[model samples]
Structures are given as structure tokens and as C-alpha cells.
Target: MTLTIWIDDWQIQCCGESFAPGDVVSWKLLEVDPEDYADVVGSERAREIDCREEHHGQGEGQDPTPVEVVSVTEVHCRYGVPPGAADTMNCPVPGTTVLVPVDEADGWAKARPDVRFAGYLVTARQVRGGDSDDVSAAELPRSPS
Candidate 1:
């Protein structure tokens, strides 16, 4: 499943530069690392040392989960677009811009070198799509022949 990543934080920069904050980007789910009990206990001990320490959170304290990113997708934002734009995954407008997979961007960039890339740095406003529609393939599994 793909998750939305806000590029408000600087990560990657093109042309020997990085993107600025308030820029919303997309990052696909890659891998997740579960927090260990030992680490949690250690953190708890450290907190104990500082009596004034305040922990604000829920669900398994002192354990931070790690997630690995597969790829970063820059959003091609359009001007005059409403604050509440269509839901990219399920846009209902006939002329509305839609969402696309990031894997397809590499091919598109290579094919059209002169073409501007996505994001605020580029001029594109709509994300191009990847190959394959919403058709399931798990129906036909391979056999151990």
C-alpha cells in the first residue's frame, strides 16, 4: 500500500539543491522495523533518571518504529486548484488530475529528457500513470511443475 509523505522536510535536491519545506511529497511503503523490548526498557530507565521527563504518546512507549522508503514521488501541483482537491486515488472529476505510480517516472524522464519533471521545481501539474490497470493477477498462481 502507498502512503502519503509530506516533503515539508528537505530530503532530496535536484541540480545540486534540495527541496524546501511546505512541499508535500509521496513515498511508498518499503520495510518496517519493529522496536525491541530491550530498547524500550533502556529508554524507560533513562526517563526514570529524569524525574521531570514527560512522555506523551500511546501504544508501546519508548519504542519507535522504523520504515524504509522504496521511492519518492513528487507531486505536480496546479494553480487555481481548490484547497480541497479531489482524492487522487479516487478522483471523480472527468478533467481532474489523478495519481500515478513513481516507478513509471524514471522511464518517462529517460524517454523525454527535455520534458520537465514533477513537483514545484517542474511545470507538470498532473502525475502520469504506470502500466497496468486495476485488474487482479493473484487469481492464477504458478504451479510447482
Candidate 2:
């Protein structure tokens, strides 16, 4: 199974299937309020989950822990939203804020294996520190003073 990390409507969440006992997944949960995360319970709480082979034998003793996770985060961007968008009851427009992994422009396109371009035009720009990288001075080299 693969580790999938994405921003849902409420929080930055992650999950993995077919994970065995003692497995661990380390992740950084950003764009989520600390209060909301700490208060997670019920169907959302993943603390000490159980994962074991069913055909091993009759239930006995404590079940093995499914997985362990360690997270560190800072609350920034609007919860599961593109920065600068005003908060409202309506859902944000899809495809307008396509999240891509950090990589070169060509590399990012190659990474999107599931997306296909049928005819619609799309623009790809490098966003560095919430701003366009094209206007950054970091792109230039320094000369001896």
C-alpha cells in the first residue's frame, strides 16, 4: 500500500492501507487548527488501533498496535483551502488549486499519472514561499563586491 497525504474539507489527513503491526507513518499536519486536531475522537481517533491476521487463531491477549504516528505542525493556510480564498459555506472550485508535490515543472507534470489533458489549457507556475518564483532575486547569481 502507498502512503497518501491530502487536504480534506476539514483537515490535513493521511492514511495507509494493508499496514501491518508495528508499522509507523510519520507526517506533518499543516493547515489544521491545533484545537481541532487534539479534540479528534470517535471515528477519527486513530490512537492504538488494532491490526492483526484474522486466521492466526482465536482471540487471545492484547492485539498488536496497528501503526504509530508522530506529527508536528503549524497552523497556516485556510483549512484545506487555497490561500487568499475567503472562507464561506460554499466549496472551493476544483482544478483551480491543483496541489502538486515539490519538484521541477516537468517533473511535476510527470508525477501526475492519473491526470489527462483532453484539450483544456492549463498553466503551471512555480510558487515559492506563497509568491511566484519568477520575481524572486534568488534566481540571480551574486558577483564579487
Candidate 3:
């Protein structure tokens, strides 16, 4: 399934690896609380993925989840607004309260290279453990030698 994962700037600065589009990655993700991230994710989007229980990583633990990087976008939170009413934009702006991305790439040459932005937007597929073709093959009936 295609999923958008949020990675915070602090999390990146603390412990993050550089990545780009088309890169497959593994990360530990947690469910995104719609009410908590409504301002950044928008109400509609939050609800859309609510049932699916969208996941995100806080740059903790060794990544074990698999996902693919599709695109990277910087989330700019405007200034001089309510605590959680700041407008979010994909493009750069002046005096942003906070900056983050749906996807993350350390040392990106384009747009604010000096400044580290937010997180990453990744496409993740749901794969149940011990359910791969290899596992099935091993379970096949054995033929007498």
C-alpha cells in the first residue's frame, strides 16, 4: 500500500541516513494520531488514513519495516497563527514556524541545503511475516528420494 510517512527534523538530526527517491528503506513505524497531527496532515487526509492506521517513525530503534521512497516534499508551517492553525505548504516560505516533509533525504542539494527540513513520504507494502513464497516452498509436500 502507498503510505505517507512523517519524519521530524529533530529526529533526522538526531539519527537519520541520507536517502532519495526510488530508494527502498526499512523503518519502525507507529500509528499517526489524526487529532494530534490534524493541522499538518489536514482533517480529510487524517480521516482517509485513519482506518488504515498510518504509520511513522521517530528515528528510534533500528528500522525493520520495508518501504520505498516515491517523492520528497518539505512541509513548511507558517508563522503568526494559532498554536495548531499554522498553514502548511510544500514550497519554501519566509518565517515558517516549523519545517518537515512527507519524505526525508539528508543533504539534499535542492532547496535549503543548509537547513535540515522535516521527514519523508514513503510507499509501504503490507507484508505478513512468514508468508513469503520461500516459506510456502518449504511447506510443500516432500517427495520420497
Candidate 4:
């Protein structure tokens, strides 16, 4: 079963660094089974395995690929101006830039050095051409899984 929970007024801890919150950020939660260490199809482990398989014969010319644990749950992020205290997790005003903290950015970066958490920062903008509000849990479709 999957559930959607709202996170508001939170601080994210990066690699020994912390970011203040001021904007609304969305993230997908990836739940991994601890007992099921076998690689799940189409999962990060499977992708890594595919990568290694593709470069198995590349020899010294190939770039080193690092593999790490595939266990991940929730991922959160934020982004550009200094954070001002906000009482809720609502979206910020349009054109507002703020620095957002990415979940496990430091750890992820260590595994994939080319990745940077700063790239997750985003500027807020108005939602157009869709339902901008009223995304209550009751409105979401539920599954029996």
C-alpha cells in the first residue's frame, strides 16, 4: 500500500549541511524491501547491473562505475533565496527563487560524483492549464495493493 503524506515546515540535512525551507517541493517515495535484496526488475539495482554488463569488456578505457545500496524511501527537495520562516508547506509566490535541500544528496553524490544537489533547486511559478488546488487525499485514486 502507498500513502501520500504532506511535509510542511521542515529542514533538510545535506552532507553535513542544512537548508531552510520556504517553498513547496514535491518528491516520490521509493520503498525498497530490506529482506528482498535480490534486484527488482526495472529498479536501480537492475539498471546498475545492466550498465556493468554493457561495459564488462570495455577494459581500462571505460570510466569507473560505483554501485551502492539501492534502498531508498522518501525523497524530498527545496531551491534560491534565503529562506524565510513559513508556517506551512504551501507553494511560494511566483518568481521566488530559493535553495531546496535534496534528500540524501550527500550520499547520492558520493555514489554518483557527477551529481550535485544544488541542481534540484527550482523557482516557483503559478500552475496553469490544470487543477492548481484541491488535491486532497480523497481526490486520489486508491489501489488495493
Could you estimate the TM-score for every candidate? Answer: 0.22, 0.19, 0.51, 0.19
Which run of 10 residues does model 4 get worst, by summed lDDT?
A: 46-55
Q: Which residue pairs clash within candidate 2?
A: none
Could you give candidate 2's per-residue lDDT for residues 1-145 as a string of tens digits?
A: 1111222222221232222223342222212222222212112321211111121222334333122322211111212344576864433233322333221111112223333211111112223344433322222222112
List per-prediction Cα lDDT, in the order shown.
0.24, 0.24, 0.45, 0.25
lDDT of 4 by residue, 33-103 (tens): 31222111213322221111111222334332222222222222223233584554433232222333344
lDDT of 3 by residue, 1-145 (tens): 3555566545555666777777766555555554444555455544433211112333344335555566665543432334454575343233442444444467342345433343443434433452311112122222122
Error of 3 at 19 (Å): 1.3
> After TM-score superposition, what is the CA distance of residue 80 in candidate 3 from its true location, in Å?
4.8
Question: Local error of candidate 4 at 65, Å?
Answer: 35
**Residue 133, model 4: Cα distance from true site in angstroms:** 1.3
Residue 41 displacement in candidate 3 (angstroms): 3.2
**Pairs of colliding residues, candidate 3:** 75-100, 100-118, 101-119, 102-120, 102-121, 103-119, 103-120, 103-121, 104-119, 104-120
By lDDT, the better pick of 2 and 3 is 3
| Global Cα lDDT for candidate 3 | 0.45
Give the per-residue lDDT digits (tens) of candidate 1, residues 1-145.
2222222112233212232232322222111111111121222322221111011222223332122233434333222423476743422122222223353222122222222223211111112243222211121121112
